[model samples]
Target: MDTQTQIIEQIAPYQPWLTLCGVLVLFLLLRATRRALRRRVDEIGYWLLGERGRLIWFWINAPGVMLHELSHAAVVLLFTPFGFRITSITLFRVQSTTARDRYGRVVRSGGRQSLQLGEVQYVRPQGKLISYVGDGLSGIAPLFGGTAMFAFLYWIATGYNLWDIPLDAHQNWQLLRPDWPWWTLIFAPYLILTVTSELWPSRQDWTGARWFMVGLCTCLLLALGLLWYTNHLARVLSLSTFMASRIDFALVVLVVLDLLFLIIAELTARGVRH
Candidate 1:
Protein backbone atom coordinates (compact mmCIF):
# COMPACT_ATOMS: atom_id res chain seq x y z
CA MET A 1 0.00 0.00 0.00
CA ASP A 2 1.09 3.61 -0.59
CA THR A 3 1.91 5.67 2.52
CA GLN A 4 -1.45 7.55 2.37
CA THR A 5 -3.43 4.31 2.03
CA GLN A 6 -1.45 2.72 4.88
CA ILE A 7 -2.27 5.68 7.15
CA ILE A 8 -5.98 5.46 6.27
CA GLU A 9 -6.06 1.74 6.99
CA GLN A 10 -4.40 2.19 10.38
CA ILE A 11 -6.79 4.94 11.55
CA ALA A 12 -10.07 3.71 10.06
CA PRO A 13 -10.92 1.14 12.73
CA TYR A 14 -11.24 3.69 15.54
CA GLN A 15 -13.30 6.28 13.64
CA PRO A 16 -16.58 5.19 15.24
CA TRP A 17 -15.17 5.61 18.75
CA LEU A 18 -13.88 9.07 17.82
CA THR A 19 -17.27 10.10 16.51
CA LEU A 20 -19.03 8.90 19.67
CA CYS A 21 -16.59 10.78 21.88
CA GLY A 22 -17.07 13.96 19.86
CA VAL A 23 -20.84 13.74 20.21
CA LEU A 24 -20.62 13.20 23.99
CA VAL A 25 -18.30 16.18 24.40
CA LEU A 26 -20.67 18.34 22.39
CA PHE A 27 -23.59 17.13 24.48
CA LEU A 28 -21.84 18.18 27.71
CA LEU A 29 -20.96 21.61 26.33
CA LEU A 30 -24.50 22.29 25.13
CA ARG A 31 -25.86 21.25 28.53
CA ALA A 32 -23.57 23.80 30.18
CA THR A 33 -24.78 26.44 27.74
CA ARG A 34 -28.38 25.61 28.56
CA ARG A 35 -27.63 26.04 32.29
CA ALA A 36 -25.92 29.40 31.77
CA LEU A 37 -28.84 30.65 29.72
CA ARG A 38 -31.19 29.62 32.51
CA ARG A 39 -29.20 31.62 35.04
CA ARG A 40 -29.18 34.65 32.74
CA VAL A 41 -32.94 34.42 32.39
CA ASP A 42 -33.27 34.35 36.18
CA GLU A 43 -31.07 37.44 36.49
CA ILE A 44 -33.26 39.31 34.05
CA GLY A 45 -36.34 38.24 35.93
CA TYR A 46 -34.91 39.60 39.17
CA TRP A 47 -34.12 42.91 37.53
CA LEU A 48 -37.61 43.15 36.11
CA LEU A 49 -39.65 41.87 39.08
CA GLY A 50 -37.44 42.31 42.19
CA GLU A 51 -38.26 39.93 45.09
CA ARG A 52 -41.13 38.48 43.11
CA GLY A 53 -38.80 37.53 40.28
CA ARG A 54 -38.03 34.09 41.69
CA LEU A 55 -41.71 33.34 41.81
CA ILE A 56 -42.08 34.47 38.23
CA TRP A 57 -39.21 32.23 37.17
CA PHE A 58 -40.76 29.30 38.98
CA TRP A 59 -44.11 29.73 37.30
CA ILE A 60 -42.49 30.20 33.90
CA ASN A 61 -40.73 26.85 34.11
CA ALA A 62 -43.48 25.15 36.05
CA PRO A 63 -44.39 22.78 33.25
CA GLY A 64 -40.83 21.58 32.91
CA VAL A 65 -40.30 21.19 36.64
CA MET A 66 -43.44 19.12 36.87
CA LEU A 67 -42.25 16.93 34.07
CA HIS A 68 -38.80 16.55 35.55
CA GLU A 69 -40.13 15.41 38.92
CA LEU A 70 -42.76 13.26 37.26
CA SER A 71 -40.10 11.51 35.20
CA HIS A 72 -38.30 10.57 38.40
CA ALA A 73 -41.50 9.45 40.01
CA ALA A 74 -42.43 7.36 37.01
CA VAL A 75 -39.15 5.50 37.02
CA VAL A 76 -39.39 4.91 40.73
CA LEU A 77 -42.87 3.52 40.30
CA LEU A 78 -41.67 1.32 37.50
CA PHE A 79 -39.38 -0.31 40.00
CA THR A 80 -42.14 -0.59 42.61
CA PRO A 81 -42.27 -4.35 42.29
CA PHE A 82 -38.56 -4.31 42.99
CA GLY A 83 -39.29 -2.72 46.38
CA PHE A 84 -38.97 0.96 45.49
CA ARG A 85 -41.47 3.20 47.24
CA ILE A 86 -42.40 6.78 46.58
CA THR A 87 -42.53 8.85 49.74
CA SER A 88 -43.58 12.16 48.31
CA ILE A 89 -43.69 14.18 45.12
CA THR A 90 -43.34 17.93 45.41
CA LEU A 91 -43.95 19.70 42.12
CA PHE A 92 -43.26 23.21 43.43
CA ARG A 93 -41.90 24.63 46.66
CA VAL A 94 -39.92 27.74 47.46
CA GLN A 95 -37.57 26.83 50.27
CA SER A 96 -35.08 29.20 51.78
CA THR A 97 -32.02 27.29 52.90
CA THR A 98 -28.32 27.90 53.21
CA ALA A 99 -26.65 27.09 49.93
CA ARG A 100 -23.48 25.05 50.28
CA ASP A 101 -20.68 24.13 47.96
CA ARG A 102 -19.60 20.57 47.23
CA TYR A 103 -17.28 20.78 50.23
CA GLY A 104 -20.18 21.95 52.45
CA ARG A 105 -19.08 25.56 52.77
CA VAL A 106 -22.01 27.92 52.97
CA VAL A 107 -22.55 30.09 49.88
CA ARG A 108 -25.86 31.78 50.72
CA SER A 109 -27.00 31.97 54.32
CA GLY A 110 -29.92 34.28 54.79
CA GLY A 111 -33.48 35.13 53.69
CA ARG A 112 -35.62 33.53 50.98
CA GLN A 113 -32.79 33.08 48.51
CA SER A 114 -33.38 29.62 47.10
CA LEU A 115 -36.15 27.99 45.11
CA GLN A 116 -36.85 24.28 45.21
CA LEU A 117 -38.74 23.80 41.97
CA GLY A 118 -39.63 20.13 42.30
CA GLU A 119 -38.56 16.84 43.86
CA VAL A 120 -39.43 13.14 44.04
CA GLN A 121 -38.59 11.39 47.27
CA TYR A 122 -38.38 7.61 47.07
CA VAL A 123 -37.04 4.77 49.15
CA ARG A 124 -35.08 1.94 47.62
CA PRO A 125 -35.05 -1.61 48.90
CA GLN A 126 -32.07 -2.10 51.18
CA GLY A 127 -31.02 -5.54 49.99
CA LYS A 128 -32.08 -5.65 46.36
CA LEU A 129 -29.23 -5.92 43.85
CA ILE A 130 -31.33 -4.36 41.13
CA SER A 131 -31.77 -1.16 43.15
CA TYR A 132 -28.38 0.02 42.05
CA VAL A 133 -29.35 0.17 38.41
CA GLY A 134 -32.79 1.37 39.30
CA ASP A 135 -31.40 4.29 41.23
CA GLY A 136 -29.26 5.38 38.30
CA LEU A 137 -32.13 5.06 35.87
CA SER A 138 -34.36 7.12 38.14
CA GLY A 139 -31.72 9.78 38.43
CA ILE A 140 -31.24 10.00 34.67
CA ALA A 141 -34.89 9.75 33.74
CA PRO A 142 -35.38 13.48 33.21
CA LEU A 143 -32.95 13.57 30.30
CA PHE A 144 -34.71 10.86 28.29
CA GLY A 145 -38.10 12.24 29.25
CA GLY A 146 -37.12 15.82 28.42
CA THR A 147 -35.71 14.89 25.03
CA ALA A 148 -38.99 13.19 24.15
CA MET A 149 -40.90 16.25 25.34
CA PHE A 150 -38.70 18.60 23.29
CA ALA A 151 -39.18 16.52 20.13
CA PHE A 152 -42.93 16.43 20.63
CA LEU A 153 -43.20 20.18 21.23
CA TYR A 154 -40.97 20.88 18.25
CA TRP A 155 -43.24 18.76 16.07
CA ILE A 156 -46.36 20.48 17.38
CA ALA A 157 -44.95 23.98 16.89
CA THR A 158 -43.18 23.51 13.54
CA GLY A 159 -45.24 20.69 12.06
CA TYR A 160 -41.91 18.99 11.39
CA ASN A 161 -40.57 15.89 13.08
CA LEU A 162 -37.07 16.47 14.38
CA TRP A 163 -36.17 12.76 14.18
CA ASP A 164 -37.38 12.64 10.57
CA ILE A 165 -35.03 15.44 9.52
CA PRO A 166 -32.09 14.32 7.41
CA LEU A 167 -28.82 13.92 9.32
CA ASP A 168 -26.98 16.04 6.75
CA ALA A 169 -26.35 19.48 8.30
CA HIS A 170 -26.80 21.41 5.06
CA GLN A 171 -30.01 19.56 4.27
CA ASN A 172 -31.31 20.19 7.79
CA TRP A 173 -30.85 23.94 7.37
CA GLN A 174 -32.63 23.89 4.06
CA LEU A 175 -35.52 21.99 5.59
CA LEU A 176 -35.93 24.65 8.31
CA ARG A 177 -36.77 27.36 5.78
CA PRO A 178 -40.53 26.97 5.70
CA ASP A 179 -42.56 29.61 7.54
CA TRP A 180 -44.24 28.37 10.72
CA PRO A 181 -47.90 28.95 11.64
CA TRP A 182 -48.99 32.22 13.31
CA TRP A 183 -50.13 30.48 16.50
CA THR A 184 -46.80 28.70 16.77
CA LEU A 185 -45.06 32.06 16.75
CA ILE A 186 -47.10 33.15 19.74
CA PHE A 187 -47.02 30.07 22.04
CA ALA A 188 -44.23 27.83 20.84
CA PRO A 189 -41.32 29.84 22.22
CA TYR A 190 -42.71 29.83 25.74
CA LEU A 191 -43.43 26.12 25.60
CA ILE A 192 -39.98 25.26 24.26
CA LEU A 193 -38.30 27.61 26.74
CA THR A 194 -40.04 26.06 29.73
CA VAL A 195 -39.09 22.50 28.77
CA THR A 196 -35.46 23.07 27.88
CA SER A 197 -34.72 25.10 30.99
CA GLU A 198 -35.38 22.23 33.39
CA LEU A 199 -34.24 19.33 31.23
CA TRP A 200 -31.06 18.55 33.15
CA PRO A 201 -30.85 16.72 36.43
CA SER A 202 -29.85 18.66 39.54
CA ARG A 203 -26.71 17.98 41.61
CA GLN A 204 -28.84 16.27 44.22
CA ASP A 205 -30.20 13.98 41.55
CA TRP A 206 -26.73 12.68 40.68
CA THR A 207 -25.50 12.43 44.24
CA GLY A 208 -27.81 9.61 45.21
CA ALA A 209 -26.80 7.44 42.30
CA ARG A 210 -23.00 7.57 42.30
CA TRP A 211 -22.55 3.90 43.10
CA PHE A 212 -24.93 2.90 40.33
CA MET A 213 -23.04 5.04 37.84
CA VAL A 214 -19.69 3.60 38.84
CA GLY A 215 -20.95 0.06 38.49
CA LEU A 216 -22.60 0.80 35.17
CA CYS A 217 -19.41 2.36 33.80
CA THR A 218 -17.39 -0.67 34.89
CA CYS A 219 -19.74 -3.02 33.09
CA LEU A 220 -19.68 -0.97 29.90
CA LEU A 221 -15.90 -0.86 29.90
CA LEU A 222 -15.67 -4.63 30.28
CA ALA A 223 -18.14 -5.18 27.44
CA LEU A 224 -16.28 -2.82 25.16
CA GLY A 225 -12.97 -4.45 26.05
CA LEU A 226 -14.33 -7.89 25.17
CA LEU A 227 -15.59 -6.62 21.83
CA TRP A 228 -12.21 -5.06 21.10
CA TYR A 229 -10.43 -8.35 21.91
CA THR A 230 -12.65 -10.25 19.47
CA ASN A 231 -12.08 -7.67 16.69
CA HIS A 232 -15.80 -6.80 16.64
CA LEU A 233 -15.30 -3.33 18.09
CA ALA A 234 -15.50 -1.49 14.76
CA ARG A 235 -18.91 -2.87 13.95
CA VAL A 236 -20.27 -1.85 17.36
CA LEU A 237 -18.64 1.53 17.06
CA SER A 238 -20.34 2.02 13.70
CA LEU A 239 -23.65 1.83 15.53
CA SER A 240 -22.38 4.50 17.91
CA THR A 241 -21.59 6.74 14.96
CA PHE A 242 -25.06 6.26 13.57
CA MET A 243 -26.68 7.16 16.90
CA ALA A 244 -24.44 10.22 17.22
CA SER A 245 -25.53 11.42 13.81
CA ARG A 246 -29.16 11.16 14.92
CA ILE A 247 -28.60 13.56 17.87
CA ASP A 248 -26.57 16.11 15.91
CA PHE A 249 -29.68 18.00 14.84
CA ALA A 250 -31.11 17.95 18.36
CA LEU A 251 -27.95 19.52 19.77
CA VAL A 252 -28.00 22.19 17.08
CA VAL A 253 -31.61 23.02 17.95
CA LEU A 254 -30.65 23.32 21.64
CA VAL A 255 -27.77 25.68 20.86
CA VAL A 256 -30.01 27.84 18.72
CA LEU A 257 -32.65 27.96 21.47
CA ASP A 258 -30.06 28.88 24.08
CA LEU A 259 -28.71 31.69 21.94
CA LEU A 260 -32.19 32.97 21.19
CA PHE A 261 -33.11 33.23 24.87
CA LEU A 262 -29.76 34.72 25.82
CA ILE A 263 -30.21 37.41 23.16
CA ILE A 264 -33.73 38.19 24.34
CA ALA A 265 -32.60 38.46 27.96
CA GLU A 266 -29.67 40.74 27.14
CA LEU A 267 -31.87 43.02 25.05
CA THR A 268 -34.57 43.17 27.71
CA ALA A 269 -32.01 43.97 30.40
CA ARG A 270 -30.59 46.79 28.26
CA GLY A 271 -34.02 48.13 27.30
CA VAL A 272 -35.29 48.11 30.87
CA ARG A 273 -32.27 49.86 32.41
CA HIS A 274 -32.14 52.68 29.89
Candidate 2:
Protein backbone atom coordinates (compact mmCIF):
# COMPACT_ATOMS: atom_id res chain seq x y z
CA MET A 1 0.00 0.00 0.00
CA ASP A 2 1.11 3.57 -0.67
CA THR A 3 2.15 5.68 2.31
CA GLN A 4 -1.06 7.69 2.27
CA THR A 5 -3.24 4.59 2.06
CA GLN A 6 -1.32 2.96 4.93
CA ILE A 7 -1.67 6.11 7.01
CA ILE A 8 -5.43 6.24 6.36
CA GLU A 9 -5.82 2.60 7.37
CA GLN A 10 -3.96 3.18 10.63
CA ILE A 11 -6.09 6.22 11.49
CA ALA A 12 -9.45 4.75 10.41
CA PRO A 13 -9.93 2.98 13.73
CA TYR A 14 -9.28 6.14 15.73
CA GLN A 15 -11.09 8.60 13.50
CA PRO A 16 -14.06 8.83 15.79
CA TRP A 17 -11.93 9.76 18.79
CA LEU A 18 -9.97 12.34 16.84
CA THR A 19 -13.15 13.86 15.44
CA LEU A 20 -14.65 13.95 18.93
CA CYS A 21 -11.64 15.84 20.23
CA GLY A 22 -11.88 18.32 17.39
CA VAL A 23 -15.52 18.90 18.13
CA LEU A 24 -14.70 19.41 21.81
CA VAL A 25 -12.04 21.99 20.96
CA LEU A 26 -14.46 23.86 18.75
CA PHE A 27 -17.09 23.67 21.45
CA LEU A 28 -14.74 25.24 23.97
CA LEU A 29 -13.77 27.99 21.58
CA LEU A 30 -17.37 28.87 20.93
CA ARG A 31 -18.13 28.75 24.63
CA ALA A 32 -15.35 31.20 25.39
CA THR A 33 -16.54 33.46 22.60
CA ARG A 34 -20.06 33.47 23.96
CA ARG A 35 -18.72 34.32 27.39
CA ALA A 36 -16.59 37.16 26.07
CA LEU A 37 -19.54 38.63 24.27
CA ARG A 38 -21.89 38.16 27.19
CA ARG A 39 -21.02 41.43 28.92
CA ARG A 40 -21.74 43.43 25.80
CA VAL A 41 -24.91 41.49 25.20
CA ASP A 42 -26.10 42.22 28.71
CA GLU A 43 -25.32 45.89 28.30
CA ILE A 44 -27.33 46.02 25.13
CA GLY A 45 -30.18 44.16 26.72
CA TYR A 46 -30.24 46.66 29.56
CA TRP A 47 -30.00 49.61 27.17
CA LEU A 48 -32.96 48.35 25.24
CA LEU A 49 -35.17 47.68 28.25
CA GLY A 50 -33.54 49.75 31.04
CA GLU A 51 -33.15 48.28 34.55
CA ARG A 52 -36.11 45.94 34.28
CA GLY A 53 -34.91 44.21 31.13
CA ARG A 54 -32.25 42.21 32.93
CA LEU A 55 -34.83 41.03 35.40
CA ILE A 56 -37.19 40.21 32.59
CA TRP A 57 -34.51 38.20 30.80
CA PHE A 58 -33.67 36.40 34.03
CA TRP A 59 -37.28 35.37 34.61
CA ILE A 60 -37.68 34.42 30.98
CA ASN A 61 -34.86 31.92 31.30
CA ALA A 62 -36.06 30.73 34.68
CA PRO A 63 -37.62 27.63 33.19
CA GLY A 64 -34.24 26.48 31.93
CA VAL A 65 -32.76 27.14 35.36
CA MET A 66 -35.58 25.21 36.97
CA LEU A 67 -35.10 22.33 34.56
CA HIS A 68 -31.38 22.32 35.28
CA GLU A 69 -31.82 22.16 39.05
CA LEU A 70 -34.61 19.61 38.78
CA SER A 71 -32.40 17.30 36.76
CA HIS A 72 -29.91 17.20 39.61
CA ALA A 73 -32.64 16.76 42.18
CA ALA A 74 -34.07 13.86 40.23
CA VAL A 75 -30.74 12.06 40.16
CA VAL A 76 -30.42 12.43 43.91
CA LEU A 77 -33.92 11.11 44.43
CA LEU A 78 -33.18 8.26 42.04
CA PHE A 79 -30.26 6.96 44.09
CA THR A 80 -32.07 7.29 47.36
CA PRO A 81 -30.64 5.25 50.22
CA PHE A 82 -33.77 3.16 50.54
CA GLY A 83 -35.35 4.39 47.30
CA PHE A 84 -37.60 7.01 48.97
CA ARG A 85 -36.17 8.49 52.17
CA ILE A 86 -34.49 11.67 50.94
CA THR A 87 -33.22 14.07 53.55
CA SER A 88 -32.31 17.30 51.79
CA ILE A 89 -32.59 18.94 48.42
CA THR A 90 -31.82 22.40 47.00
CA LEU A 91 -33.32 23.24 43.66
CA PHE A 92 -31.17 26.24 42.81
CA ARG A 93 -28.54 28.51 44.34
CA VAL A 94 -27.52 31.56 42.38
CA GLN A 95 -24.56 33.57 43.55
CA SER A 96 -21.87 35.96 42.41
CA THR A 97 -18.22 35.18 43.08
CA THR A 98 -15.19 37.29 42.33
CA ALA A 99 -12.88 35.91 39.66
CA ARG A 100 -9.49 34.67 40.82
CA ASP A 101 -6.54 33.03 39.17
CA ARG A 102 -4.93 29.66 39.88
CA TYR A 103 -2.54 31.31 42.40
CA GLY A 104 -5.43 33.18 44.04
CA ARG A 105 -4.79 36.56 42.45
CA VAL A 106 -7.83 38.53 41.34
CA VAL A 107 -8.34 38.05 37.64
CA ARG A 108 -8.86 41.67 36.71
CA SER A 109 -7.63 41.32 33.12
CA GLY A 110 -10.92 39.81 31.94
CA GLY A 111 -13.67 42.22 30.99
CA ARG A 112 -15.94 41.16 33.87
CA GLN A 113 -15.36 41.43 37.61
CA SER A 114 -17.32 38.47 38.94
CA LEU A 115 -19.17 35.35 37.89
CA GLN A 116 -22.82 34.64 38.48
CA LEU A 117 -23.25 30.98 39.27
CA GLY A 118 -26.22 28.67 39.71
CA GLU A 119 -26.01 25.41 41.59
CA VAL A 120 -28.20 22.46 42.57
CA GLN A 121 -27.58 20.79 45.90
CA TYR A 122 -28.75 17.44 47.24
CA VAL A 123 -27.66 14.84 49.74
CA ARG A 124 -26.22 11.52 48.67
CA PRO A 125 -27.10 8.12 50.11
CA GLN A 126 -25.24 7.65 53.40
CA GLY A 127 -22.86 4.93 52.29
CA LYS A 128 -22.81 5.54 48.56
CA LEU A 129 -20.40 8.45 48.60
CA ILE A 130 -17.30 6.26 48.35
CA SER A 131 -17.08 6.38 44.58
CA TYR A 132 -16.06 9.53 42.78
CA VAL A 133 -18.07 8.22 39.85
CA GLY A 134 -21.28 8.80 41.76
CA ASP A 135 -20.31 12.37 42.52
CA GLY A 136 -19.30 12.78 38.92
CA LEU A 137 -22.68 11.57 37.74
CA SER A 138 -24.45 13.86 40.19
CA GLY A 139 -22.35 16.85 39.26
CA ILE A 140 -22.94 16.41 35.56
CA ALA A 141 -26.54 15.30 35.64
CA PRO A 142 -27.54 18.56 33.98
CA LEU A 143 -25.35 17.98 30.94
CA PHE A 144 -26.98 14.67 30.13
CA GLY A 145 -30.33 16.10 31.07
CA GLY A 146 -29.70 19.30 29.18
CA THR A 147 -28.68 17.44 26.03
CA ALA A 148 -31.81 15.36 26.23
CA MET A 149 -33.81 18.51 26.83
CA PHE A 150 -32.20 20.22 23.86
CA ALA A 151 -32.92 17.24 21.68
CA PHE A 152 -36.55 17.36 22.71
CA LEU A 153 -36.74 21.11 22.15
CA TYR A 154 -34.91 20.83 18.86
CA TRP A 155 -37.43 18.25 17.76
CA ILE A 156 -40.26 20.51 18.83
CA ALA A 157 -38.74 23.58 17.19
CA THR A 158 -37.68 21.88 13.95
CA GLY A 159 -39.69 18.67 13.82
CA TYR A 160 -36.56 16.67 12.98
CA ASN A 161 -35.37 13.45 14.56
CA LEU A 162 -32.48 14.31 16.88
CA TRP A 163 -30.68 11.00 16.46
CA ASP A 164 -31.56 10.66 12.80
CA ILE A 165 -30.25 13.83 11.16
CA PRO A 166 -28.53 13.25 7.83
CA LEU A 167 -24.82 12.64 8.07
CA ASP A 168 -24.34 14.66 4.95
CA ALA A 169 -24.27 18.16 6.41
CA HIS A 170 -25.66 19.82 3.30
CA GLN A 171 -28.58 17.49 3.03
CA ASN A 172 -31.91 17.82 4.96
CA TRP A 173 -30.98 21.18 6.56
CA GLN A 174 -33.03 22.91 3.89
CA LEU A 175 -35.90 20.56 4.56
CA LEU A 176 -36.03 21.57 8.24
CA ARG A 177 -39.42 22.76 9.44
CA PRO A 178 -41.06 23.11 12.85
CA ASP A 179 -44.41 21.40 13.02
CA TRP A 180 -45.19 23.06 16.33
CA PRO A 181 -47.57 25.97 16.77
CA TRP A 182 -46.69 29.56 15.92
CA TRP A 183 -46.29 30.50 19.58
CA THR A 184 -43.22 28.27 19.68
CA LEU A 185 -41.36 31.00 17.81
CA ILE A 186 -41.63 33.18 20.91
CA PHE A 187 -40.85 30.65 23.67
CA ALA A 188 -38.39 28.51 21.74
CA PRO A 189 -35.53 31.05 21.96
CA TYR A 190 -35.70 31.21 25.74
CA LEU A 191 -35.84 27.42 25.94
CA ILE A 192 -32.94 27.01 23.52
CA LEU A 193 -30.87 29.62 25.38
CA THR A 194 -31.50 27.89 28.68
CA VAL A 195 -30.59 24.49 27.30
CA THR A 196 -27.41 25.73 25.63
CA SER A 197 -26.25 27.77 28.62
CA GLU A 198 -26.82 24.91 31.03
CA LEU A 199 -24.99 22.48 28.78
CA TRP A 200 -21.57 23.75 29.85
CA PRO A 201 -20.79 22.61 33.37
CA SER A 202 -18.98 24.96 35.79
CA ARG A 203 -15.69 24.44 37.66
CA GLN A 204 -17.41 23.27 40.84
CA ASP A 205 -19.35 20.80 38.77
CA TRP A 206 -16.10 19.18 37.56
CA THR A 207 -14.34 18.93 40.92
CA GLY A 208 -15.34 15.37 41.84
CA ALA A 209 -15.96 14.50 38.21
CA ARG A 210 -12.36 15.19 37.13
CA TRP A 211 -11.08 11.97 38.57
CA PHE A 212 -13.97 10.10 37.06
CA MET A 213 -13.11 11.66 33.71
CA VAL A 214 -9.50 10.56 34.16
CA GLY A 215 -10.66 7.03 34.91
CA LEU A 216 -12.84 7.06 31.80
CA CYS A 217 -9.99 8.19 29.56
CA THR A 218 -7.66 5.63 31.10
CA CYS A 219 -10.18 2.87 30.48
CA LEU A 220 -10.81 4.02 26.96
CA LEU A 221 -7.10 3.93 26.16
CA LEU A 222 -6.70 0.52 27.75
CA ALA A 223 -9.68 -0.85 25.91
CA LEU A 224 -8.36 0.33 22.56
CA GLY A 225 -4.92 -1.05 23.34
CA LEU A 226 -6.41 -4.40 24.22
CA LEU A 227 -8.48 -4.41 21.06
CA TRP A 228 -5.38 -3.74 18.96
CA TYR A 229 -3.37 -6.34 20.86
CA THR A 230 -6.10 -8.93 20.36
CA ASN A 231 -6.40 -8.26 16.62
CA HIS A 232 -9.95 -6.89 17.05
CA LEU A 233 -9.14 -3.37 15.93
CA ALA A 234 -11.44 -3.56 12.94
CA ARG A 235 -14.44 -4.42 15.09
CA VAL A 236 -13.77 -1.51 17.41
CA LEU A 237 -13.38 0.77 14.44
CA SER A 238 -16.78 -0.25 13.19
CA LEU A 239 -18.39 1.36 16.26
CA SER A 240 -18.48 4.68 14.40
CA THR A 241 -21.01 3.13 12.02
CA PHE A 242 -23.44 2.47 14.83
CA MET A 243 -25.30 4.96 17.06
CA ALA A 244 -22.17 7.12 17.36
CA SER A 245 -22.55 8.34 13.79
CA ARG A 246 -26.08 9.49 14.42
CA ILE A 247 -25.17 11.26 17.67
CA ASP A 248 -22.18 12.97 16.08
CA PHE A 249 -24.27 14.19 13.19
CA ALA A 250 -26.89 15.58 15.54
CA LEU A 251 -24.25 17.35 17.63
CA VAL A 252 -22.68 18.82 14.54
CA VAL A 253 -26.03 20.23 13.58
CA LEU A 254 -26.58 21.73 17.02
CA VAL A 255 -23.09 23.18 17.45
CA VAL A 256 -22.93 24.73 13.99
CA LEU A 257 -26.29 26.36 14.41
CA ASP A 258 -25.26 27.67 17.83
CA LEU A 259 -22.05 29.17 16.49
CA LEU A 260 -23.86 30.86 13.64
CA PHE A 261 -26.41 32.51 15.89
CA LEU A 262 -23.94 33.51 18.58
CA ILE A 263 -21.66 35.18 16.08
CA ILE A 264 -24.51 37.06 14.54
CA ALA A 265 -25.74 38.24 17.91
CA GLU A 266 -22.29 39.38 18.92
CA LEU A 267 -21.83 41.34 15.72
CA THR A 268 -25.23 42.91 16.04
CA ALA A 269 -24.51 43.95 19.60
CA ARG A 270 -21.21 45.51 18.58
CA GLY A 271 -22.95 47.35 15.77
CA VAL A 272 -25.60 48.69 18.08
CA ARG A 273 -23.04 49.85 20.63
CA HIS A 274 -20.98 51.68 18.03
Report the number of clashing residue pairs per model.
0, 0
Whole-model alpha-carbon lDDT for candidate 1:
0.78
Q: Could you tell me which 10 consecutive residues in candidate 2 have the lowest summed lDDT? A: 82-91
Give the Cα lDDT of each candidate.
0.78, 0.64
Models 1 onward score TM values of: 0.80, 0.69
Alpha-carbon deviation at 6 in model 2, angstroms: 18
Compose the digit string of candidate 1's lDDT tens values, residues 1-274.
Answer: 7999999898888766666776777788788877777676677777888857747667878888988999999999999988999999998666655667768787764554665777788898776779887898999888888889988888877667876663355544433326656576467767877887788888877876778889889999999999999999979877878878668767777777778877887787778767
Q: For model 1, state the Cα shift of residue 143 in Å.
A: 1.4
Cα-lDDT of candidate 2: 0.64
Q: What is the lDDT of residue 135 in candidate 1?
A: 90
Clash pairs, candidate 2, are none
Error of 1 at 182 (Å): 5.3
Candidate 1 pairs with clashing backbones: none
